[model samples]
Target: MLPSDCPISPLPRSAMLYCEIYAEVKPGLFSSEAKSQSSDRTMDLGLAEDHFSRPVDSFVASDIEQLKQAIEECKRLILELPEHSEKQKDTVVKLIHLRLKLQELKDPEEDEPNLRILLEHRFSKEKSKSVKQTCDKCSAIIWGLIQTWYTCTGCYYRCHSKCMNLITKPCVRSKVSHQSEYELNICPETGLDKQDYRCAECRTPVSLRGVPSEARQCDYTGQYYCSSCHWNDTGIIPARVIHNWEFEPRKVCRSSMRYLTLMISRPVLKLREINPLLFNFVEELVEIRKLRQDILLMKPYFITCKEAMEARLLLQLQDRQHFVENDDMYSLQDLIDISSGRLSCSLTEIHTTFAKHIKLDCERCQAKGFVCELCKEGDVLFPFDSHTSVCHDCSAVFHRDCYYDNSTTCPRCTRMTERKQDLPDEQDVGS
Candidate 1:
């Protein structure tokens, strides 16, 4: 509801845009011919309806005719799908996609005012389209068939209003950000959305709405993963360690990261848009220093070898002699700035470090049943119709059967067995 002073009454019959909204915004205020505010204490507010956000007019005849044609063409394509050879599988997929799109267009119940605004942002910069054009994204016809569309003036990439979200790469047409990120929900690589939630790992249907609980979602990408793939409780490191690192809701791996977490090193590289400095640094690590793929993929956020070792995060360190002890974190941002002749550190100490510092109970990566610590088996060896039991202290994931077999103690807990007596020497050591 609006504030107490604002009226809920309907707009008057002759109420035009600005003139009507002025009273609705500030009831006691009056506008002068000069169109300047008489009061400096004017509230910072906006009208419910403004000149920019005008109501859309009813569809004209030509627009309705084109919509009908598009529908007819989609139906025709569906009928032809069966007759074509199996090589034309994309046609079948396209038909299904078109049906979903048509249903969305027809459904008035879908509350997507925000989505509509975001989709229109791409069209805001388009110039006149006097000639026919094809959509840059779907490679579908735009102008002749669907007249109300947009084309990037610089690159001439044409697209339909609904299809504005199919774009992925940096706009060669312009370097401007889109109006709303919500409209671009479809993953450029994986064609999934809230309506069609799918597991990024398992490649199967996942639930976002209408379920006991929704699957874990990526913060950046909005992709969902099945519970079996990404359980929320697998912490392996100290709580502070997990909190120290930066994380986004985006899935970093190009594919399913079987036993990885979304907690990534800052200056994380999107493999497709690799910065030159990062690209060169990676080359030095992989080619010149000959680092393993596993080590490179870890991409620890630390700067010097000493910091990693002191932090007790080198759970999987292969070497110690190669690094110096007292160095600050390697700064990729500084390196990039220096390359542009900003005169940063001329002899930046590039540290070569490899370590895994996450506490099995660490806050970043979730608990996943992988390689049963007791049985030495793989992939969360749970018994039929039961969840894997994880040790709270040690962060080891094992089946209930394994837990019982080990007499209720996690194999990796590293504490003395309950039956073991504390000897005099042990007590002294403890003290």
Candidate 2:
């Protein structure tokens, strides 16, 4: 400690200040050696993995909302910190960790932040130890000992769930089965290895595996189509041309304009074709952004009939089977593109010619024309109004008169009465 006698001269003022600024240990930057710093960063980010690495099924909406709130709070804290404070640096590092967790919850796409708002999240039955250590997502080396992981139950591919959205891959074939009732019955082999069939339109070598992809089979036409070729079948926008575009009219449009951009940008994605309901939701937001009221005037603006909604959902399938995963239906690529001038269609255009099947839900009291089961032979259309009555005893809804005439009491109520009659009275039991 006898440094008072030491002859070392002081450095320049700038150098001394620089050292002082850097001398304080930063949040994520743990050490001077590159290897140590790298390890430190990994550990810092791994906090999320430890907390949220549970199977997707285990997480409820509340848990997800909590994580989201935490992320926002962290951002706020960081913003309030002084620019040069070590606390500020630490908070920024925390923000990165939080963002990565949020990313795991989204579908992959281009510059657009999220693919869609996933209402129900799905996860594989398998986890880190059961699956491979390599990330199927980024194809980066991920050590299982250090990081947690997830696996696809359909393809058995191990990756971070977020990684599932990054690249185009074949569709999962585990759910396909023969449908005898299907009028159009041509199906080429669809197992993972059969990448031989060519798309009818684009002639891209297609695989039934449905990876990035092969021909999408048409059970209606007995044909297979590549994703781009199927775009013609979907009729969203005229083949990638910003100008002179003609969007084909459709009752059930699968992919959105934003989805096309993601495909072009080359992010692997695991998703099903979106149902019309979800698509219209995205479009409505677009309408609000652009102030286009035309969507309100459209015929199918509101959907009341569950049967009709199911019919539109049927249009989402390439074939009459559930997809292993739905492709990203949610994306802001069209808006992003319009803003960046990559695609045409201004926000203000009443008819951007999207051919979008915009839809709305009926008000609670407005539903009508439901077939009444009680009027079995006559098959009358029962309005949800005066015509409808729920049984007091059984809670079954039926036409009011039909229920009263056929049986004064519901069959379930009658059975319940008979059962009560057979039971001993409480007084008798006491005696």
Candidate 3:
């Protein structure tokens, strides 16, 4: 409190009024040294007010520290006042204002690491009347018109622009790193009790018995999420595409949708190894298999042929060089393409080009072709020919009718066996 004789022309009216009220309410709140301390505090407040007028970029470490001290001073003054009193309430509001100012001064970019999830945040235009979407960081209701907010494209993580920098939670898409393989089980839901009756994402309390908060299940992850976390977003599940050959979009949680979106193009699913019967049932898959096989056969010829190399024949596969490298493994996108006949049409075009080069265009490639051993025919037959049969053991090509007539036995294998027998006899005779 200031002395009665001291001049108080420099101090603000509000500061003077506060000092008078503080002294009256709690006389012992300030000591004999209070006058000097209060003067210093008034000077600090004056400096702080001047600093607040300046831009946030101009705020130095000392300015932030001064603001923090002022905030603490406000809290201490509030604690000394009576409960529910106007003075206490006023001080509390001041403290909150000071804290907000401090937050504004601090640079969020300086504190936070670069976010790993590449969130494609879009301005939320449509508002749902039934369920209010709250910010994931602050849990404040997002008013579409009054408050400008963003929702992630893939994960659907919603937040106000003010709360975005404060977000520490990694996106559901990033969480997919924990999963080494795709979830094969269809909607493998462990009951809500298993999840402790909480959301799989935010851990917010969720209950099926409750009327307002109904738990939504993600068909992809088989985990339950609250309405905010699961937006009924649909995506093509990789497991479904591989197992059931189903490309239909199914309801999935935001995280699952994001995960599926990322995995769609990744060639990790070994379709033939996982479900071989798909080849028998799906005609497109069967055709794809045949085309891949022919591609593999043509690979050897293309590699050895100078003319094919000059033409860059293998470049015909483009991004699908994997078709020649491996036959069985396919991506979810590959399945989707197959379903639409796009992949088969593309492979057919590639196969035709490769076939043309191997059969007629290049002599080096033609020289690699097999003569029908069973028929002793002068005509050369490529393994890719429809009427030719390949030996399982020796891979020798023969005319299909002649092979079947020869009891499907490989003539090359018989000759090799006879050669081995003759070698043993010759060694015994030499000994």
Error of 3 at 295 (Å): 1.5
Per-model lDDT: 0.37, 0.39, 0.70
| Pairs of residues clashing in candidate 3 | none
In candidate 1, position 366 carries an lDDT of 19
Between prediction 2 and prediction 3, the one with superior lDDT is 3
lDDT tens readout by residue for model 3, 352-392: 98888888888888888898877787678998887888888
Quick one: ranking by TM-score, best first?
Answer: 3, 2, 1
Q: Is candidate 2 or candidate 3 better by TM-score?
A: 3
Best candidate according to TM-score: 3
- State the lDDT of candidate 1 residue by residue for 185-291, as single tens digits: 22334334743666665555667562533566543243666554444433212111222222223342221231122221222222222222334543332232223
Where in model 2 is the C-alpha error above 4 Å? 1-67, 93-431
lDDT of 2 by residue, 390-431 (tens): 665655556777777775556556777888886778557888
Clashes of each: 21, 22, 0
Best by lDDT: 3
Please identify which of the two predictions, 1 or 2, would achieve the higher lDDT against the true structure: 2
